[model samples]
Target chain A: MLKIIQRWFIRYSEQDRKLDKAVTGITGRRPYNIRLYRLAMKHSSVAAETVKGFKESNERLEYLGDAVLGAIVAEYLFKRYPFKDEGFLTEIRSRIVNRESLNKLAVKIGLSQLVEFEGRKRSNLSHKSIYGDAMEAFIGAVYLDKGFHFTRRFIIRKLLMQHYDIEAVIETTTNFKSLVIEWAQKLNHKVEFNISETRGSKHNKQFKVDLSVDGEVVATGNGFSKKKAEQDAARKACEALDIP
Target chain B: MLKIIQRWFIRYSEQDRKLDKAVTGITGRRPYNIRLYRLAMKHSSVAAETVKGFKESNERLEYLGDAVLGAIVAEYLFKRYPFKDEGFLTEIRSRIVNRESLNKLAVKIGLSQLVEFEGRKRSNLSHKSIYGDAMEAFIGAVYLDKGFHFTRRFIIRKLLMQHYDIEAVIETTTNFKSLVIEWAQKLNHKVEFNISETRGSKHNKQFKVDLSVDGEVVATGNGFSKKKAEQDAARKACEALDIP
Candidate 1:
């Protein structure tokens, strides 16, 4: 199984020799447990008709992979781009793990070439969606085969680290918190987000937000809803500061 | 363009010997015109990005495939199971076109093998999602390759025509409408969904609902005020009817 997996990937990595080499390198260091990876790639449809002795498809892995991928991506994006706000991080994360992007990564990693099937009719279809799913599965597989720490290292080095461009990212991005924090962080300053007042009794409370830096209020906003008001205030602060 | 298209699918179909032989049995030709069939297999993501000189992706095909797959599946299920209601149709559709199912179809069609990508990493990934996505894309591809008439025919043959055990499906299914209407519809059914009044109507409006399946009034419900009341009333009627 390990040999089959290795040979399959080695043949599939047509675009980038480096990526192919990386996959081969992993197997060489210690033969990857292909079972986990295979299960990760399983699709439920393929698993559905199997009477018995069937490899359960990747549904379980997809569930686990979603959480694993989300955590890893969230952590890396959170710390690497300290100035970035929630929205900024979300967009990049979306860009990174969205179906299209996942597909792209799968293509990059050469996971699509290693899929196996019992039937022949539907075998020659596109692997874009599967590639992305499998990539996530592969990540999940690595974590299982090796460990989280090992998987984390692979993710950071192979995917995230190379794409880490905080300054360029901030410049290109347009999230209020991200822009403000990113700019402030760049300028070597700290930002203070304080809810100056909460009005309108507990029954239907309203928050008054004052966005400030260095004890100077840059923006103020209000909402029947506190969160909304804070977001509005933050947005205004970002604009007025003209930082990003 | 059509000839080139025909040639493409013929070559593609040939890769899966069984499917190729099966298709050839129908067309009795080595290369056949299957533009719509190919389009059905196309994923929307691929179609969207094709202008980037990467026309091989199935993203767009996936989009159209989704709709085609849904419609055909719904129609077939509707006919096959005379006792099944709208809800039953919906459930079956969900089951058939769901991410897991489509991935299986993709695998069945060997769609992952047909996708043109830069390398095998993508293919090595879960062919399930791509298979499913491509299954939708394949449906889309079929729509384009064979047009609507043949596409629907193919759907029945390939998907719904197969014994679905829809009677069993009906028993296990929940029919909200039936639950609401069973009592009234059975006993002089004259249900009227009247909106008595609406208040605090914003983007997402709150509705007032009343149940009067027959000339007899059954119930009234209030939610967020009125609309919620009507829905609750309908829910109550459903319970009274004793339809799961």
Candidate 2:
């Protein structure tokens, strides 16, 4: 695959060798398949045209990649920071693995140099999200080539363990209820969650809550479980205040 | 900001100079203050427990990062794929730049390295969403350090421009209505959303939709909006089928 991408990159890139070397320098742990890389690079504009009447592209891979990446990262964080709660986990993750970040990372690793687009839309294209999708595709490629254990090690070595405060980062992203409450306290205000009712039974109890600050409801939420309910309620409050 | 971060990373990463080079290489063009780095690294726990009693974690930064990331990614997709419509753009952004993705990226980029913990719950504490939030904090740091231009450049270079066929990926995510139809067609089943109408004028309209598959009513939903009604109906159907 790397050979194929090497061929493809050689064909279009002005600084073909340099680009190849740069991308390879960072990603050359294992070679990527050319066919996959081709699909990764060809914009939907050209790829979706259906060569040989085939309707396949990297869409499924991207979808899978999105989920797989989330699962992998979630598992990693889960193991790395056992003390962190859900809210902190959610917010921090929102910051890092986003489409924009992955896309930017892909470009930094030189995926941009390999991309091929058409339709005279370079200056006016709408395929920006592809940047990250391609990165996922690349991950998919690596997964297929190297397997999960290898991929995990590669990600940890190249990505996670590279630089991080795993303990503190995990702790912060985990607790949103605390985060919101803490914020309200900082404002020197009393926070109250007016729970109108806990409607369901113990097995499937649902709580309806309205979180308020200084008498006005800031967030309304319902959850099947009590803890989830309070967290949901707090999350709503945070969103309403635009305060993480 | 980059200079400060570079210097700090170089100073801290005394053993692995390769990582130092990688960190400095990514942010070589900018110069950020140590305060920004500290803020980026400050998980809410440490910030909340500070001696000054000032809770100044990246939580606020996470909030800002979420919105800014959304706007920038939206704009990027809009420009990158000139032919795509609003729904496509939104769905792609939703999938690619979701909280889960951001969390993964944050962890990938070492946001965990900056967190501060509360109790000794590190052993059993496990929350998965923080990586993205830290990624957002990092974005906040980048924005604070380099402003929007470089921040935009940073996101583009790192995240969105890498892999997926952005157009098709977006198209795949957009328009659940069409998706249902497409899925039904593929399954050789008739899928109909029967909207039983209630009386209303131009200003107010109420709709009750009975979503059916293969002539069997699946779920019913009532909404002022056809879109909402459809979504609720779809959600019910999906829930009924335990889809995903």
Candidate 3:
């Protein structure tokens, strides 16, 4: 009985220490409400519950965090690229907050060691996206605990500046729509994309996008998303016309 | 010369008085940077200028305001609807902040009387969206002058509570996509949308959507936006099939 009691105490203390370390590591301060941080780290697959008996998941926090992150990123981009148009700002923001980018950032911030989820949830959850979700939830928790200004500072100064190469991202990213538009402008040709047909059931429908150059169909592409199909068609048109 | 000078003096004081009234009406506090508020009310067509020699319009401020508004709205929705899924929250947010809604809200706040733009600019600018843009710029100015916490409180308590019927919006606003999905489930039938064909040029393309029910095309719709086209198709399908 004494041995069992000792084991339980050691495990409990270890867990407590780990949580404290994570709070300190992420926020650079002692947490005001450790429960929020704890909830942030708990993935929905674990079915976490609040002290008030409300079923809890990081999903709501993720939503809030996503907005917070967007606002901060938008402000940073707006100030950094004062002369850049809204399209440029939006594209840069997307590149920064995209699932792939966020996933990488979350791992960089040591969330991989801290987040909790059931192994079974791995069936549907991509290994990377869950971490991204958790990162958003963590930001949401930070927003709630310390408020927007502090969260903005944490995201902009601590997370984004520390991890992302903003200049490199701006230089590297290109939109196919812009590429097609530029090509059209240079060649003095008009290009258009129209949805000739839509197929499938409501939610999981497929889009068939046809790209036309100077009133002639140049290429066609298919995707579940219209944007994807449009991009696909543009890429093909680019390849076919040798206008890279 | 004395009469001309007197006229200029009177006009300038009138403009100053109008600005002060506008600020007090919108923010409920005296503005610190009156120039920012003036810039917020200035439309691009008017070609307003700052003392710093930058061509001043509300565009950059609009971008900042959009992000700030989105963050505040997201937080409000997150807290108010704890159990709602991300899609529901997103749809609701879209309803509240859409161009049409914001335009109306801007007018409600008496921005129509205050915002300045050239008559020539009005030819291309849809009367509604310009106000919405100005509203966002106004919010951006508020965020800058007052900080995030104050801006958040203004958005949530002053703007939203005063102007909007939150419960009515939550109850009445139904996404066409969601409506179709629910109808399909009730009838135990499968439905889908597929993009069969696309036409037009790159940026100015139209979407053609065909709604299929039980392996047959029931209705077709065309629109500039995919979502609009889809909603059109869905509504037609709903009407034809008596799927109310």
Candidate 4:
């Protein structure tokens, strides 16, 4: 068929073949459309402008991929923890898909090697999430190249099962401050962390934070730094409120 | 053949038939599993507890459906607006899926008729989103019963095409206060609305609100109530900052 020949011609280039091999090394399958994977690797730092004036980058794909990933993960957790409440499922899902976790996952999966970005711009603090963003965009590429069922299989089999240990992911302690803030948002409660006390010397300082919800002091925690103290207080407050 | 007979027997009951008809009316297809639809209609206010100590309600389904609906909508918008940026797509998607909009959509789709809740508890302000919650649960039910491709078609053809005008949905104004708050959350900016002044008589008073983002006053607005004034100020601030 003419269509089959055209497809073969598209994949005949040496550059396309190299991209195909790299993507296959990562995803365990050859990309049907090498163009999607190419775009997925393209970071906004070195985006190409199309003739229509649209800067071609991975952002749009990232947005779509984020949603697909969320849905797949939601269903996965829902089935895995049938007895757990929605809050528990939400908390665990967030732990798995948080920016930091995704960044680590991307690196572990060999995505960092394939991602294309300006070398000079890599040192900027904002580029820390570049790999994670690219990972999501790569997911978008998979979803588009295949379909939802195939994409779901790829995520669960290739990504989650191969890379992540679910039990360890559940046991890992995350930022309690963010947890409590999210809980407060859901319940429409205002949360504030106040530095109640400072003790010890300046070089070896200890900070105490009082965590309040709805103007009521719920818990207090002490740590070596303000951020740590706030996180500690938040953890205690979460326990007191039975957030999860 | 035995499985087909079992399915027929399951749908033979009068109550099952009514529910099947109702669900068919909304989704344009008979559910493969009517039990999921039944659970979808079960509101938490009148939840039934199983022997395993699990409460049978729509909450978990709502969570899953929320993710599925988000993914579907994201893809729909992505393909529809290939030239639009992610921010614009996010804003429009939020406009379509926000609580108030979903509540209205639920009512318009006649989902309110199928949702079951304690009538006495319905008067509570928190029950305002019950219909929307049920709509999402129904989506989850459909996804479970029919799978993703069928559900996507049902949403695009039945829910979106039949009930909503995309142009009108886009043009409809939403709560700017929530929009600004969401934008601030993304950018790690603190937003505050300060009542700058009160004028006119007590019975017919006017409130002036100054909206500030990250400690800088960006805009001010006047209205009959503090909430209204804050919304007005937030709207102006959104325009000033070019947020979507």
Candidate 5:
């Protein structure tokens, strides 16, 4: 039919083909609607105004993607860790989908290169979550174009299977300080991290942190920065108390 | 086939028939997996120990259901308000799914009756989100048994369409205090609520609240309780500033 030929012509247009090729590299499938992928890459910083005065950006898509990602990850973790408690599942899910992790994942998957933004206005952007936000928006685009089951498959196969090492992700101690603080709060115990000592020159300084619980110094740690020292102390404290 | 007859026989068994009838009233469909529905109704307070010594309760289901519910609601709101910003979408979604709202929704849908818990140990349960938690677990059960699309249809048709008046939900001023506080924090403005006055006798006392922004009193409201008075003042402030 004429409509079919017209659709094929539009899909195979020079610009559309270029976009399709780029998107296919990341998603492992040819886009059903290249426009959605384009919109996914269009950051709010360089958003265009529609005829109705609405800014066409990836923010709405990001919101949708965030929810989809959360659900898929929750189900995945639930099935994988059948015997694990809900608290452990929640903790691990957070670790995987946190902004820092998403940002890194986006870069790892070559998604960061596709995101379009006003480079000059980068400094005005308060949060360093643009790449992660775009990754989420891309997911939203996939969901809209291909539906939930297909999107879930893409996320599991393309992203999780190809990129993430689950065991290593679980073992990462990046958030030990917050974890220890949360554990203390649950037990109704007061936790304090104090910088007990400083050593070496200004540029090459080592900070020692003492982690106290209920006025008792339970653990000590040393590192190049105060935050690092605190986290190290918290990790030690977690080990001593069997917090995990 | 013998297998098909066996499946049908099990589905219509006496006890299953009763559960199917009760659950059909809520979800408008006979459960594909009756055991999941049973688990969904089982509260942690009355959880049975599995052969592996794990407590069998609705907590895991609640976690899964929470994510699924969030995704479905996010998508619904996204499509319903195409022109609305992400912040507006987020606010409305939270208003719809927050603990208080979900608790009320659960009771409204008659899901509270299906929940099994220890009545004597109710005080020890602490959080009053049992009904809401069971509602979420029920959703997880539906998701696992019937899959995402069927669950989405049930939520939209049985829950949102039948029970919720979206306009009234949007107009509800229950969370005005938290909304105004959030607004103030975003703008880096100092907000304070002061008890301006207390009047009348003990049984019929009226509390007056003055809501201030950046050291200036913006609104005043009176109610029977201090919390109510603060909410009233916050609502007035929101109206004065054209917040919504």
Candidate 6:
């Protein structure tokens, strides 16, 4: 039994070397524990057989990675913005870790090409979050294999510093709806959103949303969705009111 | 000006030593960066004045600690329960780290006696979550001072392993309503909770709730609140059905 287990591990180690090369190409660091990276890439739908009847997927790793990533980001922001309040820190962190942001980051890091999932038909049909989930699981794998400071350096230097434009993210007010609402609340004013128009076909529709503050229409915007339109209008309103 | 600044540091370090002794007693380890621990014990309401006009409070540290604690817990759960799914892991993590749990743990570690806050009238009026928040901030301090491995050992050995009974926590179904609902969903069975009776005056009211599964009554419970009554009913129902 011991010999058989050793042989099995040797076979898997060869497979792991190829993956390590790919991971090194992206991360600029060879992984210490290749099994973690393998598990990180594995999707829940394609569960591998284990001695315990079935191998678990990247879900747990994703969960772990998400938390670790959050801590790294929070610590980074805390140190970077010394005079900034908790609210500012929270907003910036939210902008950084939001689903859309992570998904975009995942795609930029070539994660879409590496994740192990079912065929394109099944994956594209239902798992829009697969790439982002894999990105998080990969981070978890890095943390487990390399520890916190190393993971922090990888995130800061390799991912955020090398790839991302932090200054642009800070300057942009893309999540205008939330920002506008928050600003209004701070000023003790009521804010309202109204869907003024919905046009075009069922499949390809356009929405016009009007944002009002203290019962006065402040801005109007049009987009493919109500949420988008509201955000657009809120952006214009913030620009007009000098909300910063 | 230089002499004044030097004097301030001397005074603060003196205070920090007392705090260090208290922390040592709790963790069985001497803290290296005593300033972080000092910040952890200092509440926001009593912000100390500094040469920079106002010294920052523990709020930022609390935020950092909360994220670090979450990561630590996620790592612990991930390694400990290899067979458990993400949902099960999340549930157990929540049980360990939720506000009430942390508050209890904080009191157990004698944190309530060491924390510095405003006088009774100010702190008692609003800062109910002080203990739990300080507990998180202290964890953050530990991470910053000692790094991840030492922090992990401290949490696993000093807090979770030494102080907490992990097996009892796993076995006890404190959140019966969620458990029963999860079980019902797995079996494709409908569950309904109805408040059967309300009695007594406005300030001292009682509620009786009945839980039904698949249109049949499974159990009944009574309590001071509707939520409590529902939970009571769910607990009995879970026992009756032997869902596990």
> How would you encode candidate 1's per-residue C-alpha lDDT over B1-244 as one tens digit per residue?
6655656655444535554453444323332445444444444344543342234445545544565565456545544654433443455667666787556555554555554333345546533465666566555555555555676777776554453444554443235444565656566668876666566648645666667665566666545545345556676677665544
lDDT of 2 by residue, B1-244 (tens): 4465565653444423433343445555534444555555556765654432235676756655665576567556645754543444556788877777766565565555445445425552535555566677667666666766677777887666543345555434225566677777877989888887664787888777888999999888666777667766775676676543
Please give the range of 10 consecutive residues that has the lowest summed lDDT in model 4 chain A.
A2-11
Clashing residue pairs in candidate 6 (N, C-alpha, C atoms within 3 angstroms): none
Q: How much DockQ does model 1 earn?
A: 0.01
- Pairs of residues at least 3 apart in sequence or in different chains that clash in candidate 4: none
Each model's C-alpha lDDT? 0.57, 0.61, 0.79, 0.84, 0.86, 0.82
Model 4 lDDT, residue A89, Cα: 82
Worst 10 residues of 5 chain A by lDDT: A2-11
Model 2, residue A49: what's the lDDT?
45
* Local accuracy of candidate 5 as per-residue lDDT tens digits, A1-244: 4433443655456766777888888878777777888888889989988844479999999999999999999999999998877877897898889899899898898878778888734554545599999999999998987889989999999888888898888767568998999999999999999999999999989999999999999999878899878978997899899998
| Per-residue alpha-carbon lDDT of candidate 3 for residues A1-244, written as tens digits (9 for 90 to 100) | 4433443444334665687678778778756666677778888878656643355788878888999999999888988877765656877898999998988888898976678888833463546688999989899889987777788888888987899999888756336767998989998999998887798899978999999998999999777788877886886787798876
lDDT of 5 by residue, B1-244 (tens): 4433444655456866777788888888776668788888889989978845479899999999999999999999999989987866887888888888888888898877678888834554545699999899999999998899999999888887887888888757577998998899898999999999999999988999999999999999878899888988998899897765
Clashes in predicted model 1: 92
Assess the local accuracy of residue A242 in candidate 2 as a C-alpha lDDT between 0 and 100. Answer: 84
In candidate 5, the residue pairs with backbone N, CA or C atoms under 3 Å apart (3 or more residues apart, or in different chains) clash, namely: none
Please give each candidate's TM-score.
0.33, 0.38, 0.67, 0.73, 0.72, 0.70
Tens digits of lDDT, candidate 4, A159-202: 89988898888755456888999999999999999999998898
Better of 3 and 6 by TM-score: 6
Give lDDT tens digits, candidate 3, residues B1-244.
Answer: 4433443444335776778778877789766666677878888878646543356688888888999899999999988987776756886887889888899998898876678888834563556688999999999888877778889989998889999998888756336657877898888878877775577789977888887877788888666777767876776776687775
By lDDT, rank the candidates, best first. 5, 4, 6, 3, 2, 1
| lDDT of each residue in B24-45, candidate 6, tens digit only | 8987887766778888888987
| Model 6 regions more than 4 Å off | A1-9, A12-17, A49-55, A121-126, A177-244, B1-14, B48-55, B121-126, B178-244
- Residue A194 of candidate 4: its Cα lDDT? 98
Q: After superposition, which runs of candidate 3 have C-alpha atoms over 4 Å from their true positions?
A: A1-16, A48-55, A120-126, A174-244, B1-14, B48-55, B120-126, B174-212, B215-244
Estimate the lDDT of model 1.
Answer: 0.57
Query: Lowest summed-lDDT stretch of 10 residues in model 6 chain A?
Result: A2-11
TM-score of chain B of 5: 0.68
Task: Find the candidate with the highest TM-score and give its number.
Answer: 4
Which 10 residues in a row give candidate 3 chain A its minimum summed lDDT?
A3-12
